[model samples]
Target chain A: MSAPEASVAVRQRRGSFGRLFVSELQLVFGRRRNQVGLVVLLGLVTMLGVALKVSQLRHPGARGGDIISAVAGNGIFLGFAGLTIEIALFLPLAVSVLAGDAIAGEANLGTLRYLLTSPVSRVRLLAVKACALGVGSLVGALVVALGGVLVGTALFGAGPLITLSGSRIGIGDGLLRLLLAVLYVTVGLAALGMIGLFVSTLTEQPIAATVATAMVSTLLWILDAVPQLDWLHPWLLVDRWSAFIDLLRDPIFTDRMVTGLWVDLAYGVVFFGAAWLRFRNKNITS
Target chain B: MTATRGAAGRRTLWLVAAGALAAAGITGLMARGAVADPTLPPLTPAELLAKVAAADVDGMSATFEQRSDLGLPTLPTSSLPDGEDLSSAIALLTGNHTVRVWVAAPDKAKVALVDGSTESAAIRNGNEVWLWSSEKQQAKHATLDPSAKPTPTATPMSPSEAITKFLDEIEPTTEVTTSGSGYVAGRAVYQLVLTPKDDASLVAQVRVSVDAQTFVPLGARVIADDGTDAISVAATSVDFTRPSDDVFAFAPPPGVEVTEMTKDSAPSGTEKPKGDAKEPTVHGTGWTAVAISPASTEKPDKELTTILESLPEVSGSWGHGRLLSTALVTAVVTDDGRVAIGAVTPERIYAALAER
Candidate 1:
């Protein structure tokens, strides 16, 4: 082919990849299951906000101005409290549902083969799927947080946030911290999403992939809970799930949060790399 | 096609190998950083125990910080009236507190907890004891009876007193060993580890750091069976010189509210129950000692009930109750309104209750 035609082909390829990325995002988010997961998460955050408001009202004279009670006085803190309650299990489960289904669900439905037959490179295809899963996980986290903010503001109203360190922060700064907390939690869940994506690539059964991903997350949580397993704490994926608590501190402790980010980054690289290598070479029989 | 697949498999294998190597290296680095001095001379279990038992320091004052991460469920504090200070144990376990303790031997000692801007102090000077809270601007005066035994104060335990209590409870069921050496407050110390032999006990080990030269316990940590530090106390700074007598003497400021407790009067504002009714009845001895007591008259509040409901229930010949088990402590409140708390297991607690 001539040089001009080759350049045109390259432009067409880049354009097609962009289209694929957008289409992949829509496909993942358009799923009923993923939507239901977000709704359920929102429901949980609402329940938590209501419970906290009721508890605060019932006991007006609670001692100590700790962060948990700070939520009762200010709606902005509800986002932090909601994230704290859900990061343990529900958030991961929601992310897993999307991530675990990203690849395996396509294969289960027998559409993976058709997708592979397209002019798309296998690497680009996997990258798009991973990005879509990452976006899905972030949205899942935001749904809970935004839901918390709305419900909390309706019940408790917004005010200056009283930090765990006993310092008060204005509503604007408190919301900024809340945003950082949400991003931090999303990054952690995205790492788990990569693990789920890797697990999904190994099996044709979407349910099995989801279950495997959740089992892995649960195992990490169990390891974190065991004090005798201190050797494994630094390496466990969920070990720093609570590190977001540091964001609520007065000076904002970023040491643990930074370490958690690094841990999540490492997990994402290794697991996603493994998934790519495996999927790149696997025979697409489906 | 076959050769291409073979190459792909080889690449995947190498990728996994590299990942494992990186993980192991990181873990190794972390493990190395956690230990202090690993090459110290090893003391035999018997020698270590003897050293600990003989450990004593006099006329010393230390400023210490304590942190407790027991992972305990929150309990309601509604039973405690407003303006009443938290019990020392609760305050110590709940948050960070800087405590200055002065021990001048025989009967003179003082402990002051410094809050951000306020200070609460308990001073025992000869027969006169004074409790002062700057936040409340109140002071309580109690005169000790010369004939009656000295009553234990509700103040947080001094590091020396805590070490003495731990040493007194040593039994054959304890597996004692020297963990190695470390520095506490810039002083070289030997770490002595004591592990309970009881399988049901949540206490994995109790580590006591002894000052190598003075044999003073500079630090002590209670490690639960799960490996988490349930309670840790360390002297951040120490001065061997005796604090002046003025440190132990207290005269309330003119504007502060003063409540004087005579010998017959009940202890004012102190959460501890007065008289023998509050004393826990010890059952068994050593590592398996279970302290049984009548349940508190204060009802469990909403929050405490929720926490109790979350705990697993255990039933035995002694009756049914919920058990709160941590790494080093197990507490059981039975259906009969009796409470048994110990470092032993729920079964052991039940067994002790049955013996009663």
Candidate 2:
């Protein structure tokens, strides 16, 4: 083939992968179960906001220096409190649903053979699925954050925000920090999603993949909580899940948060690499 | 097909090998990053102590971390109304904390204890002192006598302040020696090891790292006899330059509750009824000393009572009491209400109570 024709063919393949990624995202979000999972996440956030508001009302003068107690004073705290509660269970559960289904669901439905027969490379398909799961994780975190912020503002009303440093900040700065927190949480969930993606490649049963992914994350959390196993906490994926609380401080402690991001990146690399290797060689007999 | 299959298998093996190599490389890199001991001019224990005494630092700002592994049971705070404060007070004796401090020397200092989602700060500017809690949205201010010496409350927030208490017991009880030189908070420092001469003492040793040039203490650790860290406080980062003046200035934030306290007036409910309160009596000296506070007339809280009841019961010539023994400290609480505590063995505490 001539140079122009060869270049045109390469461009066409690039465009096809772009379309593949878009379709993958649509496939992830359009499913009824995935949509329900997101709504459930939002519902949990709303419930947290209402519970905090009710407790604040019941105990008028009660004082505690936690995110839950801070919710009464600032509507902004609802987002913080909700994310803190949900990250341990609901957030990981939601991400697992999408990530565990990424490849396994397609293979289980017997569409894997058809997709392989198409012009797309196996690695490209895996990348598209991973990207969709990344977006899914981001959406899951946003559901909790935005849901909590809206419901909290409606209940407590927005005003000058108080930082953990006993100092006050304007609403604009508070919202900015909230945005950073959302992104930080997104990275953590995405790291867990990578682990789920690898598990999905290991099994043709999406249910098994989902359960295994959820178990891995839960195990990390369990390891993080045991004081005797503290030496292992730094290596656990869930160790810094709550480090987002540092963003609420006046000077903003970034030591743990930055380490958390690095930990997430490392997990992403290792697990995604494992997923690619597994999927690249697996025979799609189903 | 067979040829391609063989190639794919080879590729898989190569990739796995690469992954393993990468993991090993990263682990090796991190292992190498453990800092080596920094060399400094050698000094004897007495010279180092004198240097710390004469050292003067005008102003600085720093962040520090304190960790205590006292091997105490988790306090039952779930059912308590003042659970946050109760747990926070207990957390000071156990677990880990990060603190930010700013000192402008003569009468201007601020220490912010940063916990999970809240901060409590104590700021002293000239004759005025402020205690603020972000969680409660409250600030308490008190004006001190201008003529009184500028002695802030004794807070073990810094390595210098925390180590000073142990340094006071440097007489015959502590075997002082210079272990070596090293680095703390990125500054070259000398390690002064204080080993308790008494075998009954639960403390194995106390190690303080003093800044080589300035002689200011930058880190300290208390090792228990069981080879565990009882308490470790260190400056994670530091800056010796004077902090900005605005950091010392304080005006209560708009929404916070401001309470002005009069001179010499303790907060209501905190002051014990004067005549009934007996001063704590000390039995022994230095590391093995035990302080016994007489039985209180006031009723102990239900939570405190529950905690006390959970301790192991012990009876001897001292009479029956609950004994709480940790790696670094032992406490004996008699049924009649006397409590004896010291960094000594349980038998020593029991013996002290019997003598009393």
Candidate 3:
């Protein structure tokens, strides 16, 4: 092919992928229901900033030890705890919303048959769709993280990202920590994508896929919270959600980090692979 | 451009959060006369460090209370860390974490570890802080900081006297006058609302009983502003003697990988305890020990009865324990300028100095 022809072909391929990804993004953020969650997170970050600033204006002598002790003992932390904790609790659901709709949404819409009939293979198409969803969700997660930091800094004077242990990092450092924490949270959230993708492949109905993935995440959270279930503690995907907390430590204690990351990765692999397999076997005639 | 001790910062945090502007009717917690709210002014970063370095403990002794509202992590109840981030970090969060503290001057303190699920903390020696899990009986030891070298031949002081001395350093700024009546550890007690002018100076309200029969910390609150309370211990065995030489040293168990630091070190990303911020009280490794008051004096004492009134006939708890040895005594004056002696155990011999 001549240069223009080749460039045109490349442009066409890129355009097709971009269109597919945009559609996925629109499906999630484009919905009115998802906007509620988005606003909620935004409010959480802003309020967290306000709360922290108020505390400083009121009582600046507090210590890190006091904060750390409180967090460890009570699972209470500073800043939009309601929202941060919520994010920790529900980010998975958000990921599932997008991922779970992947193949199933297409199938339910009757577009899966048309796409499968093209020159593209079903497995490749599913992989591409999954990738697009994961990236989109990851970007959303970053947005949420940025929202928290921005508001937290504005209200708290960007002094430092204070932790439950009373340790702090200056504004620059705080941002860095927030970034790291968000990244970890993102990875954790991504696992939801894998599950969502799996459900999407298993069910031909988008609603069923979304509901199943959400139920799975909720069950994991319940299992993690119901103490005395030592036997099941290590395996629950939600248990890893707390790994981000380690990032708050002065030194960022990580004996659990390694384990948590591994656990999350394992979940992603199993669910993602299962989804890929299911999609490969998905019959278009049905 | 200033750094305050983390521990000190925490105490300061308590003081600030206390919003401890002395209101009316508060007494015992503060001196009787109106003390002009004791200069309840906002402290700068510099003043905080100076105050930490200035803390003096003759022969200190008291069970401390450690509390943190979730903006920060676990820290000493009375003494906070000397890190830069401490104040700002804690100021941003609402942590409902309280711990009961027990400190036996110059050295022994038990911190109740708070571990989200169930809090537990045992003895802490130098860098090795011990914590027990509620579900498990076996204790786990983690290294924090390396034990500092023992202080060279140091000054002598009495336990109670040292405590009083500590009291001198932190003259009460807040006061509480109350009509309500109550009891603590079985003693008839009057309540007082104490707001601190200098937050870190308050361990708890020094409640003095209205009735001569009760020594209920003079209507003081046993808790800090954070709602963290100290483990109450009345001088069950009041002795003015120094403990044997080996009391302050630490000898760890074998086979444990003493990573020189807690295994969680590098991962902590915990910035190295940045610049050496001046600490309020710098305790050296030199042997500093004091005969503790009765382990438990069920009822509060109306007043601090000395050896004269400390006699069993006059007081219940002060008389029974061990002999008040004065000679092995290190004549240490308390913050109030009252003379105190550190004595050996109930076993060894010493000159007995009856309270002046």
Winning model by DockQ: 2
The stretch of ten residues in a row with the least summed lDDT in candidate 2 chain B is B25-34
- Global lDDT of each candidate: 0.76, 0.83, 0.47
Candidate 2 Cα deviation (angstroms), residue A124: 3.8
In model 2, which runs have C-alpha deviations exceeding 4 angstroms?
A1-16, A47-65, A69-73, A117-121, A226-228, B1-33, B50-61, B77-88, B104-106, B144-169, B185-188, B239-250, B266-276, B294-320, B335-337, B354-356
State the lDDT of candidate 1 residue by residue for B1-356, as single tens digits.
Answer: 88977986786788777777756655653343244554556776556656666666668888676767776654444443332345544655654556778889768998876544345678889888888765565678888877886677687786556655655566467877787688777677788888888777777888988777777788898888777888888877777887777667576744356899775665654445444367779987777788998756666666556767888888888888888876567899876667899987777888888886
Candidate 3: Cα lDDT at A47: 58
TM of each candidate vs. truth: 0.55, 0.84, 0.43
DockQ of each: 0.05, 0.45, 0.01
Cα lDDT of model 3 by residue, A1-286, tens digit: 8999999887886677666566656775677866776676566555555655565557664422333222212222333243355555456666766775678877888877876764444545766776766675666566666665455444433343444333344556655665676676777777777788888887888888888888888888888776446446756777756556556544344444555666666666667666665665467665
Q: Chain B alone, TM-score of each model?
A: 0.67, 0.80, 0.27
Give the number of the best model, judged by TM-score.
2
Off by over 4 Å in 1: A1-18, A51-69, A119-121, A219-235, B1-14, B34-356
User: What 10-residue stretch in candidate 1 chain A is worst by lDDT?
Assistant: A61-70
Per-residue alpha-carbon lDDT of candidate 2 for residues A1-286, written as tens digits (9 for 90 to 100): 9999999999999998998888888888899999999889989988888887788789886767678877777788788888999999999999998987898888899987887876678878888888888899889888888888888899888887777776678988888888899999999999899999999999999999999999999989988889888667767889888999899876677867877787787788788889988898798898
Which is the winner by lDDT between candidate 1 and candidate 2? 2
Most lDDT-accurate candidate: 2
Expressed as tens digits, the lDDT of each residue in B1-356 for candidate 2 is 99977987887777677666656654543343247787677887766877887788878888888989898876654654453555556667778888889998778999998866678888899888888887677889988788876578666245454455556657578888897677777788899898999999999999998988888888899999999989999887788888877777777776578999885565533655455557899999989999999876666678778888888999999899899999988998888888899999998988888896
